[model samples]
Target: MQAIAERSPLLSKYETFERGLPSHPESIKHLRRQGKDSFEANGLPTTRQEEWRKTNVAAIGRTSFERVSQDTNSLSHEQIRSFLLPDCIDLVFINGRFSHKHSQLEDLPKDIFAGSLANALVQKPELVEAHLGQYADLGHPFVALNSAFIEDGAFIHVPSGVTVEKTIHVLFLATARDGTPTVSYPRNLFVAEESSQVTVVESYGGFRDDRYFTCPVTEIVGLANSVIDHYRLGQESLGAFHVATQKVYLSRDANFFTHSINHGGALVRNDIQALLDAEGIHCTLNGLYLARGSQHVDHQMRVDHAKPNCHSYELFKGILEDRARAVFNGRIYVHQDAQKTDAKQSNRNLLLSKGALVYSNPQLEIFADDVRCTHGSTTGHLDDEAIFYLRSRGIGEEAARSLLTYSFAGEVLDEIRLEAVRKEFEEFLFTRLPKGDIVRQAV
Candidate 1:
């Protein structure tokens, strides 16, 4: 019955959150109260909800986790350089707080306006409050929790008619020290006005703290005729738990593209939502997950077409090996006013071992008569014929399996237009695949 902010049992553990989750003293007060209201109204979701039934969150509540503390004495700068991305402006957030001293903003474009939500609260309170959480459905428990504890977050804005050449990258690296089970709510907001073009890449990581939980939320808004490319890359450490959300808002004549790539984590769930608010919008979503070991990964997506002449295409594929498990829930809702809307969605998964399992559900809810929408999903094992084809070329059986598996996963990787970035991540995925072909011989 009380606010999440007031009754987080994990409080008194992190001094950073004790400061009332910093914000523009006056302007953000109202929004903070609203977040508290939203969170209390809808607590942690349950299996009773269709979207949550497959991906259970009840067990997580049993284990208490503190907010990531600001202790970083054990980590060195040299240790973090290995996680850096190539040729992009970079910002680093350590332990749920922004560290401008360790950031690389020299590479950022001149037209873009970037700042920490903490600073933006004081300097541009009205602007931050106007658009923050404007596109997300706070009815979701995780999103509401993130909003209630609005502490450290990244904010970016690209004005209309501006063409940004370089991609903006944000890295959230949280570490749990002193045996404090922790969680980081890394909130990020991106706004692109009419005709603006930009690319944003976010990588989430953690230091060998599997007991730690990272619940992050990203919200984006795309205006008329705007073109936006975005990516969410998760490379959390071995013992980490990740719960993240990707929300996008599209206006008339706008175009949006998103790719979600997940490599490693103990338990990971990603919620991606896109709201097509206007007509003539083009949106494409491509996601892939290679979860191995005893890992559990879930990807859920919702796309809503509220107006006419909107087109959306979604393709999500996954590879599960060992005892890993995955779940995918993709839903497309076409409103009555959304006529002539062309929407297509597909989810295909490949399991390398019988122990691995995948649960997929692609649903279509159409209320319009003149719309064309189709949805389909399937889960299968590696293709025997494809493996044989590679073996016929003198490749060993084990090598053949690896080759076929990579090719199946490569379709989603190739969707990434950035050559260098894609290549780095491709190599990362190669190491995760079962040893064979290039991986074994190269090692």
Candidate 2:
């Protein structure tokens, strides 16, 4: 076939995906039908859509990007050498397709299930059908599009009363091949049944500076008495565009901790929705993003309380530099029937340059008068006094700025439960940080 084809009224991108999809002819047909219906219903989320009023994906929709290239990835061999953890279950994907060669999975507890979404479809259709697309509505064009055309996605099932001994890491690499504008929609579905515990880590990889598009959709189901810890790292090509949406459903006494760190990408927009559908469920949302040099980072989150005695806490902090822009929209919805629900939301930003920008909106729509719900949003620069204090203590100006910058993002490091992963991330994060306003260096 041709390298790239003009927009088609029939098939998306090409006849097939980046790589051949997993074995799921029936599910694929089902998804294609639903996807076409959704696309027809909602062409795309325009500026008119209140949820996307601040950030627009019209540019993505207007262009018919080329399909992913089939060339072998350079990240194959050296990845494990530089890879941080050895005692973890890892799944490696290059150009959006799973590679069996580089992955490592050992000592996983009997209860944890990890594999390609394509594999999950063929092996565990019942699990996939029972909980897919249940929490998030199909209003947004991208999400609906994802649900409609989902070929294969990551699947993790933690059985009841089993705490997985090791963390499962998913690494996705997208590279610029043949100068064609490529795209990857990596999907993930997680199921934590009653009294089960699991942790999932998603790490973004590929080139350092190349223009690409990564649109991913993730679904998480938290059953009764289950605990799940999720860490999503966005360190893609600096010129790439990332649009990801995650919808979570929480049952009775379930606990969830989700942390997102975005340090790369030209335009990044993430939407996370958490639904507390049963009593005594608790979830925490924590995030950090460093935007620089005309980059844009946006985060939209919603914590929904539809049942009684559920609690949710959300905090998002960002650092912007050199004309970078960041936005936060946090909404907590408490239905009238959700009595005694407790929800708290906060968004704070730190602007390091005169041209840097931040837009924040934390909203609470509480239909229950007896519930406790509070939401707040703040935007400001780093504390000058704190920087001055550090400089006064015989610290160089550059070192002081670095200290303050790292400290501004230091809160997120606390929430990471894994010491090895957190330490490695800190090191990488520090190396990528700009010098900032610090002009002097002290011996």
Candidate 3:
């Protein structure tokens, strides 16, 4: 592994990053060192590996992305207002560092602790140490890299028996500085205690045409009887690269729901894993991705039913056009003790052009005899009959195509519990489609 570490271009950057770090508790320092060692041992994944065969990340390993500083920049509230949600508390982070000026956290509840993870480390190190680096897999290179550079991000803790009425929005914005391609590692931890309820929104975006890299890892823990609703919106710049991982842990009788929507990024990959650690857990995972003009998007999902009497469902849809490509790999694993487990996984894709490509794979691994598991995948072009039907009903060809595309992507959007977030994405979709004005008017 020392040989591999010597060959990596990021080795020097890691050295620089380590030397500049502030002193911390032995636990965190040990975790960072462990991550550095793990990353050096495994290195960045390549297409030669089965897990990354469909997606190539050679460019990421070849590029040099400088780490961003925590100093406040010139970004203003008005510039990021569009990404803010109504009737919610917003915590803003610029290049992975929390910005108190742009954040609207005044309305945060008294019982809830929603703020920067770095702040939490200083003020409440015990709480931060309990859950940090506990759930996400360290074997993965990206996760290890994020762990090695995990300085700041959102940290939300909901105490027992408390319900947050308003949504908690955490926004991460990336901007290029001095023409230097930058990279940020945003690590977030959301812990919902027993019988508590909360809704969290994680949004990532950047300036259009900016070249950068964003590697983020989020861990969500739902205790017994807790309810957690999460939404992750990825709208990075078209020229940027994004690799993210999300790990979810559900206890007995806990309910966890998540929606992942991706609309931008030159190269994007999302890795999600959910663990049903106890009985009577209900988990739902939904995702939507739109790609066009040579963009590449990939989603790798796994649901592990480790206990009995657990239910999990996954549905992911993608739309590709103009030489765009997408990959969806979803798997369900039911352990030997997980009897009476019910799990379903589905992946569907629509190709709007002949050059567009999609690779869909849905798998199920069940060790329990009495478990019920099903998986399916479908990929094809738009329905000619449906388009013709709309065209015959007085809609133009472009408008008809736009309407069908909108309808195809609407399935996952409808699953969003936040009305404001749903509408914002709808408007974004309207602007992205051809003859969007006509479709918006007709709808």
Candidate 4:
């Protein structure tokens, strides 16, 4: 069955696109061919696979989604403006193609680089070639697919000792002006040099209610003493399928922080991997997922402590309503040479209905005896005592359940350093909180 799915028409269409995908300097072409080969060999993960046991993407394989086109004139600027971050350099992509008209690149520092990856390959091929396809795990089919079809996405470069006062926002808007189910591969590459500081926001959204597939891959490199605040927001339409892979590489004394908020899509999965390649690295990964009405959301993370004196922390929270399903898999690995490594991971889920389900697995693999590493996972109904206490304080039952649920997910939101983004998530979370009927019986 898995083999049949791999050979499905959807993959064939992807292969066609892969063959014709643009390539320049010949090396990128070679990388594209490599991506195609790897994807074909590995194929989509099956439920039988350990990493994909709880989440099945057979439906995605069965759906015949067309390749996303470059035409985005149907979407108005006003429609995409709401998704942009305030006081930030916004790089907008429509249907996997960069939009100069909708993007704001003015007044940027002279040396800093922020623009489309395709353009970067043409103008600054040397810098992009050094790290284009280096960090993405070719083992992952989605990553391979994105690599194979890599075209236009955000490309940002900050030199040493430079601090970007404003955040860099990369927004991808998926639209089906022709009313067809489409698929887009959005690839982003970020490089922060030594002692540089910056904040980046990656947002994937839809301009219409059309069914689409958004497969995006982001690779980040943080040099020594660099500080990076990264945020990913997945808010696709209800009929969309979204899968993304984010890989972060850190050097000595580098600090990298990530926060992911997933609130939309019919089937969504996020793979976040942070590599502490040098000593004295500080890494934090936090996520919040809200799903309902048969939606499926999954977040998988891996933090690798490759050197001594590194610290990593991970926390992921989820709220599921109706018949929604969620999966959280987090692993912290301390290498043999990673002495004095301190790592902690926790995953908590709140189910608002009996039909809602969650599968959580948090694991710690420590090879160094001197390291402090621990992981914890919990999945259950909302706290009854807290709900009862709120009810006893004269709050209505629905309001009480909502409050507790919000509090449960708020912990992860507090980690977002950007106040505007935090407030936006708060509004979206409140609006998505199961109203009346769904909230009445959570406790």
> CA shift at 329, candidate 3, in angstroms?
0.8
- lDDT for predicted candidate 4 compared with the true structure: 0.86
Candidate 1 ranges beyond 4 A from true positions: 1-27, 72-74, 435-443
Estimated TM-score per prediction? 0.93, 0.91, 0.97, 0.94
Candidate order by TM-score, decreasing, is: 3, 4, 1, 2
Off by over 4 Å in 4: 1-23, 207-209, 434-443
What C-alpha lDDT values do all the predictions have? 0.80, 0.78, 0.90, 0.86
Best by TM-score: 3
What digit string (tens of lDDT, one per residue) describes model 4 on residues 1-443? Answer: 35443454446666566556555767788877788788777778899999899889988888878876657665787888789877889899888889888989885788899999989988999889888888889889899878778777899999999999888899998876477788888889999999999899999998545688899999999999999999999889888899999999999999999899988898899999989999999999988898989999989898989999999998899889999999998988889999999999999998889999998888888888898888899988878898899889787887888878878887997888899799788777666664633443442
Ranking by lDDT: 3, 4, 1, 2
Error of 3 at 421 (Å): 1.3
lDDT of 1 by residue, 1-443 (tens): 96444444433343345464543565455555576667666667788997788777775666688765455334577867877877877777776677776678886777677757777777777667778877777777887777767777788888899877888888878776677677778788888988999888878887664567788888898999999998888889867888888899999899999888887688899999999999999999989888888888999889999999999999999989889999999999999999999999999999988999999989999999999999899899878887888789787788778877877877888899876568777777576665633753533
Candidate 3: tens digits of C-alpha lDDT, residues 237-302: 998899999999999999999999998899999999999999999999999999999899999999
Q: Which of 2 and 4 is the better model by lDDT?
A: 4
Best by lDDT: 3
